[model samples]
Target: MPSEAFDRFMGALRSAPCENPNRIGHAALRALQDSRIPEDALPCPELQREPCALNGVPCEWLRPPGAPLQRALLYIHGGGWSLGTLKTTRLFLAPMVRRIGLNTVSVGYRLMPEHPFPAGLDDCLAAYTALLEQGFAPRDLALMGESAGGNLVLALALRLKDEGLPPPGRLVAMSPVTYADTLEGSHTSLIPLEHILADDSFVVTKAARLYAPHTPPEHPYISPLYGALGGLPPLLITVGTDEILFDDALRFYQKARLSGVDATLLVGDHMVHSWPIFSERFPEAAQAVEQIAQFLQGRTP
Candidate 1:
């Protein structure tokens, strides 16, 4: 059973207003942008912020007080491919920065229904490459993301491997959408149980189509679960028992381990998708963050 606070949070989210599934293109973009957290109201006053462009891609560096410059993390924000922004994701990113005590670079990648599949992936690749060029060696850097961002984290690693670039020291993915070709497996059963996601609707699938209409969903870059998983860095994946993507994480972990990669999967019983994002109000969120911190610490030199 989940705690009282977790239950309450889910209730609030269930009651929150959502955009109509029929809306697409500019209409969907407008609705998502309108619903975002205002820029001026973003939290995390303790960390010094530096907004800059990395190889032409916009990114922000959030440094906790007294954080070591030697260690760095590239954080990709999630929005199911078409939504989410730096201001909207700061609530989660800020706390992770403080907990991990590293110079965290949050990438503001181009969104879908506008920039599309390769565009967002390109921006993320550019950001990672810029980080490497800036002197953060493979052993001193890590990659982390949630949802669509998590997908990019994995896709980026595979791209890096193909390009002969060294992998990051560690990787963390939370509730990632590993398979995009179909809504099969645990997705079908878990969606109805998860309060944050819809089961009967086509909203998510529509958004995915808008993002990658030309690309095959099963393409390794688009759906990393179908990609090669060997020789990647140590990985830590977290997912809630109630999320539609639970099977995605589990399958990825199993494949990664079979391929001889160091992989750890942490499942939060009765928790919703991206539970770590609610760290401000939930104990489970903090516990997940701590687990990620420990995992990263163990892999760090």
Candidate 2:
């Protein structure tokens, strides 16, 4: 049984004119996210947010009072691959920072239709490299993201392995896009009644083409599900049973386990896509945050 608030949020998503990404053009979608409440209005008085740049990519450092200094979290925001910014994800990031009790960096990587595939991926890689250069031991650092950001974190790990760099201690991907190829897995499935805030347009059409216009979607960097998962660090994945990417999460977890990676999957029954990001509105979101915190801290979730 979902909360009343979650039900209302689903209703709102169902009624939203731009709910179907196909109806709105890319520029309009970006403008829509831009039109949300200003950053200052969503106060996280308990946490301090400082804007900074990592390897020239815009990033934000979120620190709670007395946050541990030894370990840190590097976060990537999700918006297909063309939308979102540091401000857009602040709502959930702030609370996550406080709950996790660790300084966190939210990467504002480059977007597509303007930047394209390797550009955003490269920016993420650079951000991780910058963190390493800052002396955060690889084993003490963790990478986390939702949706496309989830894809990027996994891809970044693959890149690290390819470059013979040290792997992060752990990873948490929420409602990630593991299979980049539009035709694969659940991408071809019809949107189920339980699903809301997801559409074929955003994942299967426009964003895919814009982000990987030239490269094949199955490329290890684009869709990490196709990459070798062995030797990666412990992983935690969360997905809504309702979201279109549910199977994507399932398949990735299966492959990861088969590859001998210590992996855990937290499935949210009747939850919407990226539900954790709506901590303020949904109770399940807060619960998910706690579970993530526990997982990141090496406690059983």
Candidate 3:
């Protein structure tokens, strides 16, 4: 069952496409500076927000259920790495933490065209390193992210392998931002969901350039699709069929199979990127969350 809120949002996204990527960036970045939810409507009661330093890197941990979740999640929000903060995700992260009984640390990494590439990756590695130093075992941690964050999670895993560091137990990637730059047919189809994704006249092709102005979109680390996957941990990719990035998910899945990696792609219908925001209203999102929670909780830490 689709929540009215999700349905309404989908309708509106289709009705009005944000005309400017700058505006999209501004709105999403601005939305982060303020609290987006009512205090009473906060999904988790046991949350502890604190300014913490990881390897001298600034990071915040949104502690979920304290019953020693035993497992920790290093969460990165999506905004093309140019925007998005913890606020963009807590609306769903809070519920996931409570339901799955996990401690989450959401990192607001430095943006691109300034602190581009390795900057964001550095913060993520520092935060993960800090968690490791805090007695969090490799098997007890999961690197999960969305869109750009999803790309970060995957890239971070590769980084760990390169450094000979123990990897996380598994990965939860949600509609990851693949492609180091524009591909031939990235996210330009889906006319039915263009409003949900592209801005007024903007397609994934245009968005890709703005999103990664400096880096080539096809860099293995940037796209992951080009990287060797022999050592990657199991992967769980959740995306929607109606969006432009669906092909990325599909392609990544096939590649993972070729590598003999344990991977699964859960495609949501009538849903767009990060549409799980409708968790409160959409049964599918709730069910999907439950599945992800179970996927994480079921693993032995």
Candidate 4:
């Protein structure tokens, strides 16, 4: 059973108006800075957050007190490719930093409707490349993200493979938008119950069109679910039973496994989308974060 706090949070989120992305993108950038949980609530007080640029793309580095010098994580924030920033996602990143004990780089990629398809991907690729050039070995690095960021992480892995670059050691995608072209999925039936994302206005369809107006929907870089999954590193995916993209994650896991990729999926019953974002408020969220930590630790050399 979900916690009372989780239930209440879901209720409040559902009641909140689903605003237009064009406006939300800018409004969120400002509001989230003030809305984030207090720093005191973060697990790692010794975590040092520094704003920096990677390959010219803005990013923030979170360094836990005892983090290994070589091991690091490239974190991508989710907002349908339009909204979200490091400040907005600090709560989610804090736990990973504390539990996984890795220096984390949260990418602030260019958003859509402004920069579009390859722009965000390019920024992510550049950040990863910069990390490599800085001497972080492929085995010491990992990729992680939620929702659209999840989509970007998976797509980034595939792109790196295609470019003949060294692949990351592991990946964690929470409720990834694996299939962006269509709303075809088992979880589509939960549309009426989904509190965070809607079936039609979701950035996957709306903002995505603006993001990749010219790119084919099934293009591997656009919807990695359509691409080859073989030879990719081990992956861990988590999704909520009630989220609209549950099946997107499920299908991606299935494809990866069928293609001989090591994949694991954790389903949260009666939970909302990206539940791990609320780690401080929900026990399940904390559990999810622990699972990610274990996965990363197991892969780390």
Models 1 onward score TM values of: 0.93, 0.93, 0.86, 0.90
Q: How far is candidate 3 from the true structure (C-alpha RMSD, Å)?
A: 3.3
Model 1 agreement with the true structure over 1-301: per-residue lDDT tens digits: 7778887887787888344344455436645674666665547788988888999998888989988879889999887777667776776789878887888999989987778989999999999989889888888899999988899999999999989988899999988888888878877877677766566333445557887999888888878889999998999999999888888899999999999999999999988887887787778888789889888887431
Model 4's TM-score against the true structure: 0.90
- Global lDDT scores for all candidate models: 0.83, 0.84, 0.72, 0.83
**Cα lDDT for residue 123, candidate 2:** 94
What is the full ranking by TM-score, best candidate first?
A: 2, 1, 4, 3
Query: Model 2: per-residue lDDT, tens digit, 42-155?
Result: 457878888899999999988899987888899998888877778877877887777778899999898877788899989988999998999999999999999889989899
Residue 165 alpha-carbon offset, candidate 2, angstroms: 1.0
Model 4: per-residue lDDT, tens digit, 1-301? 7888887777777688454545456445445553665634445567888889999999988898878888989999988887777666776687667767789999989887678889999999999999999999998899999989999999999999999999999999999888778766644677887777765557465556777999988888888999999999999999999888888988999999999998999889998788876777778888788888889988421
Candidate 1 CA-lDDT value = 0.83
What lDDT is obtained when candidate 3 is compared to the true structure?
Answer: 0.72
Candidate closest to the true structure, highest lDDT:
2
lDDT of 3 by residue, 1-301 (tens): 5567677776776577544546555445445444555533446657766556778776666775454656788888776666555555566677766666677787877776456677888899988988889899998899888877888888898889888999998898888866645544546666556444554533544544654567676766677888887878888888887777787778887888789988888888877776554566567777777777777865422
Clashes of each: 0, 0, 7, 0
Clashing pairs in 4: none
Off by over 4 Å in 3: 1-5, 15-19, 24-43, 199-214, 299-301
TM-score between model 3 and native: 0.86
> For model 2, what is the alpha-carbon lDDT of residue 28?
71
